[model samples]
Target: MQSELILKKDVDLHHSQDPYRVQNADEIDEDQSIERQLRFVLNRLTPENFQKLVINLINLPLNTQERLNTAVNIIYQNALNEELYSHLYAQACKLMSQIKVPFEHVSSKFISFLSILLKKCEKEFDTDYHKDKYYEYLVKEAEFVTDEQKRKQLLDQANEQLEKAKQNYIGNVSFLAELYNMDLLDDAILHEGIKRLFEKQEKDEENLECLCKLLTRVGPKFDNYKNKEKIDDYFEHLRDIYEKRFSISARIRFMILNLIELRENNWTPRHESGPKRIEEIRNQVLAEREERELRFAQTVPQTQIEFMVADGRRYSLFYGYAHHILDQLKYREDFDRVLGYILKVDPDRHSELFEALICISMDKSDQQRDLIGEFFYQNLKSKVFKLDQFKMGLRKVLLKALESYMKGYKFPKKLSQILANLIRLDFLDISFLKDAFEPVKRDQLCARIMAKTLKLAAEQIGCQNVSDIFELSGLDFNYFFENFENEVDRRDFFKEMRIEWVSTIHEHQRQSVELIQSFKEKLEVIFRETGEEPLAVLDRIEPEFHKEETKTKEFIRALSVVFFEKVLHHKRIDSDKFKKMENILVNFVKEHLDLQLEMLYSVQVLAFHMKYETNFLPVSFMLLYSDEIVERKAFFKWMNNPRGKGHGIAQVFLSSFFEHISRPQTEK
Candidate 1:
């Protein structure tokens, strides 16, 4: 009866409906039965039972070597479906390898398994081929389907299968890593697998991701192996791929970066601790305990805190904390939080904090300087710190900067930006400007700081304000220029100051001022060389109108004023010269239709300003209208809605001018 039961169990295993079962169980041979039994045992493998399961596998009917080969293949094929148990499968193989088998060892069988897996990965990583096959199958299957929705369903099914294939490929690569980790397979097999992956011509993001996972798993082991140099070369190749391969997705690139960082940190993760040995874990615990003790020692008693403050040790504490805060500051966005910490710790020690901030700002980049300035401005506005503290800090920092400059360290321009911010925030009085220049004659370093400070200050405050401050301080500009060592520096300083003066005007007028200056230079050259009347010289110097219509009109209006002045001085408004000038002006207006109204308005301005000098308004109107330079419609438009309402041109002159143009053709 027991023999019948054993036979019944074998028959049940043979006739079972499992996919790995033979199609015809009745014709199952003895070897097939042994293979089926092996599969059944491996299917139930767990970490606790893996060793016993390896014994059962060894005690099979087949020879020892055949049993090892058959067990390795079954375990590998089962692991592909049970990815979470891959390490268990590897351990089962390792146990079998240690059993002192007669014919062949399980390690050799694992190498065979790895070779099979690498080939499978090569095929699986060829996603293009699988993708093409999927589309081809879809086309063939949906060829006769009339409905679009049905065809789409078939296509979706194919896509699902393709995705499943890709996941299976990744699972196989991970299994290889597990086998390598368990020491069942050597580094050469793992290296071959990685080499095959890298040598593949079409490495999609998924394939590269598989490579990253493989390296992430077994990479650290390779570092200590004999092939460390080869592993380094592989890493170098990965870096090359990351930089040059733009087609890789950002997510995959990030994974590659993480893998590289993992290797760089000696296989330790950045944010989390990796698996640690017993000694390492013990060391970590001891270190943490020591850190807790250090924190306890760092705590100051309330009475001691008061004593420290009374004894002036608070300066040391504040300076240390301030320097630490500056060192850790990475971005401007952290300024508010940093200030809050400072306030919470020692709010009354504003002077020390300010001095520390200024010193660091001078030593760092311009952005750091700007951030510090913004910090000061915000605290001042909130009344968090006294304005007097900031001023005192600035004086101290400036002295230090002067000393550094005297030592041949080139002065940092960013210091001036801090000064500018202080002046703009009213934390520093304009008198500070006068005091900054007090030692200009006595010291070259002071002169350099004063020049840079004044230039930046003028840019922040108005140039007029700076000039007024200088005048009130009794500081002479010529004296400042004479103190400079070279002529070029003096000239550059003068030119920059002049530019700052022009920059202080309204943006609209600023452009007009610059164009007016440029036109004056050209006109002077013409006047000096040709010696013609104002209108003739105006005709000679061609006006390069601005592309913007408003600016061009401004230029025309300004030119009209200068030319009118010249006409008055030379008194050369004869008919022939006036006609020539009129023709030139008319051509300018014609080239820009938008400027026609501007020309008419310019004439009105000239008439308004020189009303007492001559009655050329009517003559100018007739010339413009007769030349068709200013369209009659445009002239009417200007008369209805005129610009420059503050010019105070008389209404009667305009009306009479209009009446004169309205007269009949033969009215003489």
Candidate 2:
């Protein structure tokens, strides 16, 4: 029954679906015969099968003389049959030429080893110098064999021996080159191994060490690998270790240098494509911890010489790195380093550095953005920090600082003034604006200069405060630019300046005062019975909407005041009565429509009032444009009717429209 069961087991295993299934379960009972069967398996094996056999032979000892001779015979016969022997013999010749192997025992021990093995195996082939050389190698390997066990191990290691011989031939190159060759040979194997290594939760440290050595040697060359992801992971792992094991400065240096090189330069080495390579390098770099400590550790001390005698040594090694980055047109890093150095110096001594920072900040290069960000953090901190504190409650402090800077003797006047104005506008720090103004010595601040500074400030600091800058420079009210005693002359001058004011928003200062006066008078008329002051009216508006409302009121008051002021200077109308009448009209609009809309019922009343108060149509046109009425055709027909209260509205609306549409595009 036991025999039957065993036979059944053997049959089942023999017919099993496993690709590597053994012939029979009963065959396992004959252990010695199984060993013999394994020998047969080795002898008749194809290279693929031989590869599996080599895996099994990993560390088995091969020092026994009898087994070594047998192993030698088995391998020699197969090698001869496959012509691998000839390949080895040729490789040996190359090795012999590179290395001085003494030829004294040429035919004695060496020939005896090959002679015994070939004869025992009964294989014959033509001899050559290289063939004799291969014979000598086999003889030397046989020295490790003294018994059957050792000999068997040696025979099993024949493939390894052949690999070592080939390596010897290739090892004549530099160490780095040899390592590259090893990398090439194990390319597929290393890639898969590295992939698995990363995939496993617990990787072997020894394996990682081997991987690191290869990575450091290959460096960018790994970029050329088909499985670049593996290489990228290795770089990431290396950076991790660099942070973990190495100093922070070193890590930073590595990371920064790698990023600048890979991103700033269209670099290619082992990587096939430029963009892909840069992307891989960038991903690897950013994967590193960006803490300053890590950076400090990885950073190497750049060359610092007393004096630069050559292009290579002009800067400290770090400076050289800086130069390299700058040459790559990485303006940002260039700015950063320059600012850092500048900031390290005393504030009084930072002028040159500041100039450099300014210059870099002004450049329109791709790297300018990075440089500005870095420089802003490093050198601009002191100026910005103080300015921020001052700007918190008192905007004037910032404005004053910018003014002082602009007015200073050494400042770049045009740029500084423009910069200051931008700062005052809150597109920059008011303090920076003040600082800029003090430095100006230029005879004039042209629009182009102002525009550029505003642009830079807007880009760097943003434009949230740009519109609020009227207080800093006090508007271009230039009430003093011209003189007039005749009504016609005053009117002509007012018209010319109005043209100029419209062209230049900043020069509307005189008009600003007029707007304020007009707004006050209008408010007085609106609250005539209550007798509330202008300030009280202002106080009643929500703070959220106060700024825009105040600015608008000021603009209106200034325009009306300046126009009336000119007219009064020339006696164009009864000045006091004209002002009072204008105030009455403004107050009527404010009371009937502008402030009434706070309540829903009041909003309906405002809509009704806008229909009857046709004189307010021009102001409505200025403010609401097409939105003056809910519907255009209805408003138009109503305005055109001679009997309708909209008769005045029709004239004003048509005049405004034709003025808007017929005027040259530029004038508008």
lDDT of each: 0.60, 0.37
Predicted candidate 2 versus true structure: per-residue lDDT over 544-600, tens digit per residue? 234566435343333333323322323233434443334322432343332212111
Tens-place lDDT digits, model 1, residues 160-254: 77776667778788887877887767877778878877876254667788899889878777678588888888889889988999888899889
State the lDDT at 260 in candidate 1.
Answer: 91
TM-score, candidate number 2: 0.26
Clashes by residue pair, model 1:
none
* TM-scores for every predicted model: 0.33, 0.26
